[model samples]
Target chain A: MEKRVTVLAGDGIGKEVTDAAVVVLEAVAKKYGHMFRFDHQLVGGAAVDAKNNPLPEETVASCEASDAILLGAVGGPKWDHNPPALRAEQGLLRLRKQFDLFANLRPVKAVSTLIQSSPLKEDIAKDVDMMIVRELTGGVYFGTPSLYNDEEAVDTMPYSRPEIERIVDKAFEIAMKRNKRITSVDKANVLATSRLWRQIVDEKKAQYPEVEVRHQLVDSVAMSIITSPKDFDVILTENMFGDILSDEASVITGSLGLLPSASIRSDGFGMYEPVHGTAPEIAGQNIANPAAAILSAAMMLTYSFDMLEEAQAIEDAVYGTFEDGYFTGDLTKDQPLGTKEWTEKVLQRLQA
Target chain B: MEKRVTVLAGDGIGKEVTDAAVVVLEAVAKKYGHMFRFDHQLVGGAAVDAKNNPLPEETVASCEASDAILLGAVGGPKWDHNPPALRAEQGLLRLRKQFDLFANLRPVKAVSTLIQSSPLKEDIAKDVDMMIVRELTGGVYFGTPSLYNDEEAVDTMPYSRPEIERIVDKAFEIAMKRNKRITSVDKANVLATSRLWRQIVDEKKAQYPEVEVRHQLVDSVAMSIITSPKDFDVILTENMFGDILSDEASVITGSLGLLPSASIRSDGFGMYEPVHGTAPEIAGQNIANPAAAILSAAMMLTYSFDMLEEAQAIEDAVYGTFEDGYFTGDLTKDQPLGTKEWTEKVLQRLQA
Candidate 1:
């Protein structure tokens, strides 16, 4: 089968990394005897400069038409001065809204070769691997009644039953794919939103008898992730909780550059991106790690196209690339390799 | 001068642990040559069993009359099924409202004796002695307009200028007391509540000229705390963020059973409590760790009454008790020290 992939080489190191990932993906397709058509698109700061719109209609159109969208990084100092509506981040946010990509799947796994890169004790970072399936679209971030008045301001955390049901179902389904334990993180002990969240999870638990659902207040879960991330398999949290927890999980693995995520909608449309932002300061220097972007390609193949074997091959190549102790500047362990060297190394591993 | 301390020894190991704290506090009074009188009050499930109300009118009156309040633990299976108004947790909630304790100071320190409890590698957990000065009263946790309409629900995160000002001011003040760096954690990129929180923090930062203030969105900070906790000195965040961050901070030490918190108001009144809950499963079994309760008393001495030396003494005693490779069943680290054994060891260290 032929897969139409839309590639958003966002800005700064984004273009470099995405280019690197595309080459790897192209190689994977040829090696696997599958056809993959790649469409390049503009987004974030790059799009802002080109068409005065971070997320132009053309980009969205291309993304919607494709089976999957692969993104590098977005936003830089150039777009920082832009208004929120026209900013590079807006492009990323708009895509999430347009695609109805409610579930954000961020997987943090420490490659054995890069275990020493982390500041954490080798014991903790060595065994640390978790999948944070965050609700991408709504919660306090996008809930209604969000207003700023003269004296007081209020942001509402509104959850429709359908919204809760869909996300919970997505989390449960994802949990089934990985380890069978699903830790549903919320603030049920205090917030009414949490009460509803817990209620829905309780209602949904019986449907997936194989997955053991543990309800933890968001705060406790946050601590648990840092203290005992090994105890968890799949963490399902609200938008804000997911955002915070996913980042925390990234740090545990010791490199924001190696982390990858998939923002997916129910119809299998997804935008794969690295969790890191565009580091414009290091852009031209070619010091940024491209592994996250490369790994995101792996996720895109698996989640968006259901190409498990191909995805695993990409993952294996990524690990294999670093097995001999080579990595980008962001790797920051004992010996740091430049971006070009790491990218070439990963590609070499793939060919081998 | 005389001090009136209201002691609410709620349930389970609460009474036993609080008793140990009471002994230490008495020792503190004697060492400091101060008059400290304790009026023990009922709360949590104990209050419901005795006066049929968690925060009884009489208890509230006594609490109102006290200089500061020391809580042991609240809630268990005993009051888990009770309505919100009658639940054991409600008692603590009511007290926070009554006292208007807007600043919840949770100090997370990896105790030298119990470093083995953390799931994180010792290197990562080593320098993680930071204070999470969370805005205890505002944001999504207590936001009104929170409702469950069977099919859907909404929770309002309302923050007034005063609420933001007080919490931010409190956080800065605490930062002045500890490290010179303050990381104000919020979701200013998204939430209006965070906008106000950031606005207030920006305003208040001007007054504390000596302290360096850094802003981090809630999501980023959540991940950062795990990956790079040592970099942070004072972390100031909103209620929901704090609730999660403080718990995450607790795990840096590897054991939630070893942390304690203080909820204080501007006028110097505060409630000291263990950051952990009443573990009813191990209640009356003499296996529960009394270390957290003891540490809370130490915090009460330092933060509440300015008895720094006495607080240091208690902390030293705790470190000494654990240093000898002796610990409670909850610690499960080096040696097997039951509740009584742990308490006795600390007492010996205190008297030494």
Candidate 2:
């Protein structure tokens, strides 16, 4: 199974880490009798510097032609002064917009072996595994009345019938694949957007009788995610709420560098990436973790294409690495590894 | 010092816990040589039962005449079917509006002993002593255009020049009183509400020359608070954002049962209460934890009456109890203390 992968090693440590992940992907391909082809494309600040376009047409074409796209980190202090349209982050936003990736799957699971490193007590974080299915491209972030006049400004939290219909349906469908429990998070008590969200969720509930649906306020859900992540299964919320909650959920897992997300469209074209930003200060140091990017490769294979066995192989390798206490600086303070060592360890585990 | 305290222990656990808190406060008064007088009023479902209004005129009058108000948790499942206007939460909102309580201060800190009970890893939870200074009266909750017009619905996230100014000022003032570091949490990258929030905070930064002001998106801050809670000092956000973030922050500290909040007006009047709601199931049972309600009594003494030493004494006593691992069921799985016993413990510690 030789896959044509477009790697957007965007900027800063993205180049180093993505390069490391590429090496691992090649090793996995060899170990499994598969073809893993790589096509590099410019994005983020690099794209801005090259073509004055953060997400150039060539990059989009490359992604469109490939089976899946893997992006390294985007944005940095260099593009801090750039206008919104030309900024490094615009590349990510544009890429997300271009794909129409409706559902963002962020799995927050405490690497059980590394639970001692978590800021939370061992009992609460131990054995905690949950996936946050956040609805992308809608709600407050894209809502209207997002108007600015001479003096006053407004940002509307709007949700159309179809928008709520698809996201909630996606969430329920995702929930069906998980613990069979779905916690629909919203601000229904205050925001009309949430009331619509809850209404749609209620309507969609009858279709998936096997899945349990419970509604909680965004605030309460945010607190619950931290207080007791073990109590939750799949947390489905709107765009902005998901943006906030997913990141918060990422923290308690004690593995920011190992987390991966898949933003896929209904028709299957998707962008996979690590959740962290470009740490320019760590660029060229070879100390940045590559596991998240590598895990993203696994997600791309599992989701964008149908290769569950390969995905499992990568995930198992990650678990094995954590079990051995071989980690990048971000994961462990004492047994830190450089990018090459971590990548080699994971690939070596894959072979074993 | 004789202090006039109004007790509005409205509905369910409110009655029992308030009774327990009253016993504790009285003990403190006798121990501290502070003369105190008490006034009782009906609100929430209790008020509807007595006067057909969630916040009756008599109750409002009683609260207004008192030096400071101490409230029990309000609302329960019995009132769940009531219209929004007749709900137990409305009485609390009414009190906020009646007293013009525009600022809400919630201190979120994980107890050294109770940290084991939290889902967060112990390292992240260790030094999370942060105060969330929220603008209580403004933002999406009470903003204009917050009504359902026909099948179409609307809610506003509105703020004015003075509204932002005052809240930012209050946050900075509180920062001066605490760690002298202030984080203004908003969504400037997306929402105009946050854009205005950032502008005001930027303008106010000059006034607080010594106060270090940092601006962060609400989503990132939410994640940071959980993953590295010790990094923050004071979090300042608008009404709805505050409501969400503060509640999220509270959970990091372990139990909502141990957290207290103060809602105050610029003029001086304050309404202090535990952040948790009425637990209808625990209403008749004597096992409800009274530490939060008791702590609310401490806040009432300091913030409302300018009795700082008294407040510190109450706080120290509460901490000493937790520091010794003397906790209620909410903190850990133990032979849980009943409400009466928990109240007695904190009051007894005040003497030591």
Candidate 3:
């Protein structure tokens, strides 16, 4: 297999974690007889410092030319005071829009040893393993006539049949790959968009009769997610609800640092990244966890490159490391391993 | 003090629980030397059965003429197949719109004895006592140009400066009345409505200089609420965000049956109700917990009637019952007291 990857190691600890991720990715490539060309690019504060643009044109060109993108993290206090247009965070948003990434996949799984660290009781947190499929680039966030002034403001939440069908179909596809159950979440009782969304979901269900479907009101599901997280297989929701529920699900695992996310277009092109932000305070400390970033690389391999076995190998290595009681500081109150040490352990496990 | 109270004991457990609430209310009136006139009215499935209207014109008129209203619950299996207009839940919406009830106040407190019942660990769920103030009758749920068909759909989330200000002011006032810290939730980075909402919250903070205010993006706050629930004093957000967060907060307490809510107009006219729905399965059974409904009557005393001492009496009595190891079935796995017996216990504690 041959793949070209764009690595946007944005700023602060992003550099450290992405470095760790690349090392693991190279190790995987060596273990699997594959060729991967790494294209290092400037983004966020680094890009602004170099070319006065948060998302340099050259970087986008490189990404467009690549098979997939692996982003470390973006933004820091260095560009916090910058105007909205020039802000480092805007670079990432522009990149997503530029690629037309429409579906965001967040997989949350409770680690067996880390269940004690969860805010939820062991009985509740231990059994939670679910994926949240969020519709990106549509609905209220991007709806037209979103006007705001000193007097009034408006944000439209619009969705067409095609938009709903694609996301619903994506969810069904993903669910078929995993647990074969889909919990389509919406505010059907209130929002017009939700009513149409439910209609589309029902239509999609008829096509994929093997995949069981359940429609839940957003409010009820929000509570249900917490009350009975293990009950869910694949949670499908619109943009705003997804933004809220994905973040909510992130905390459920008790290990936000280990979570990986993928944003992909209708085709195979995708961007993978760790769910956490740049920890400037911990930059250069070598203690930040690189598991999420590494797992993101694994996601890109499976989701973009069709390397399922290779991806599962990385996942197993990461899980096996935790099983052996090797963890980063975030996972435990006891002494923890540095980024290099953790990566080495995972690499050693991958070889075995 | 003399006041007219409209009691809408809608259907199923609504009748049982409201009966329990009225008994507590009459007891409070006897103890506090207040004159109270009760006007009972039909609503929900019962109203649909009698007058063939979910919210009858006479019921609306009675509610309009009263100083405040105490509602039990609404909706049941009997009216599940009715048309949208005649549906049992529509009656509640009509009443809220009729009263122009814009500010929704839901106070969530994790009971000390029932902390073990929560899905959250004791450390996380024990200290949770926060109030969520939601801006109802606005935002995407009621926004105009909300159209839907098989092809496409749209729901606008429009907010005027006045709409934001009133809700912000209401939150600040409520914060001043309780702990003087407010966490205003919005999605300012992406949503235009949130940006305007943040602007209004900032401007309102200038008026209540003593009330410390913090702006949180809705997604981050949703996670933080579960992670550090004790940190919140007052959680104020727009309609949909509030609907989700308030329900999320409700389950954090572990005893949803013990929570109460208020929907108020600017001038203190409000309707009080238990946060739990009418439990049709347990409707005629004497096992329903009346703690939430009784506490709702307490909210009416303080918020609508301005009888703080009387309200405190009801709250303290309920807490006292729990402290004495008196458990409702919803609160514990042990043998539990019936609704009437629990009401008698609360009344006994009030007189003591």
Q: Choose the strongest candidate by lDDT.
A: 3
- List clashing residue pairs in candidate 3: none
For candidate 2, what is the DockQ?
Answer: 0.49
Q: How many backbone clashes does candidate 2 have?
A: 12
Interface RMSD for model 3 amounts to 0.6
lDDT of 1 by residue, A104-184 (tens): 999888788777666566776776778888888878889878888656788988888788888899888878878889989
Off by over 4 Å in 1: A202-210, A284-288, A332-352, B83-86, B280-289, B320-329, B332-352
Q: Residue A335 of candidate 1: its Cα lDDT? A: 74
Fnat (0 to 1) per candidate: 0.86, 0.56, 0.88
Query: Which candidate comes out best when scored by DockQ?
Result: 3
Chain B TM-score in each of the candidates:
0.94, 0.93, 0.97
Which is the winner by DockQ between candidate 2 and candidate 3? 3
Interface RMSDs of the predictions, in order, are 1.7, 2.6, 0.6
lDDT, candidate 2, B1-352, per-residue tens: 8878889998878887778778767877887787889899998988877787899998888887888888987787777788888887799988988788898999887778777656666676777889898998876666666655224455677777777787788788778877899989988878887887788788889988999999998888887887778989999988877888988888776666788889987766788888887887777788777888888888787777777787788888888887877767666577777777777788778776
On the 0 to 100 scale, the lDDT of residue A16 in model 1 is 83
The CA lDDT at A24 in model 3 is 84
Judging by TM-score against the true structure, name the best candidate.
3
What DockQ class does candidate 3 belong to? high
- Is candidate 1 or 2 superior in lDDT? 1
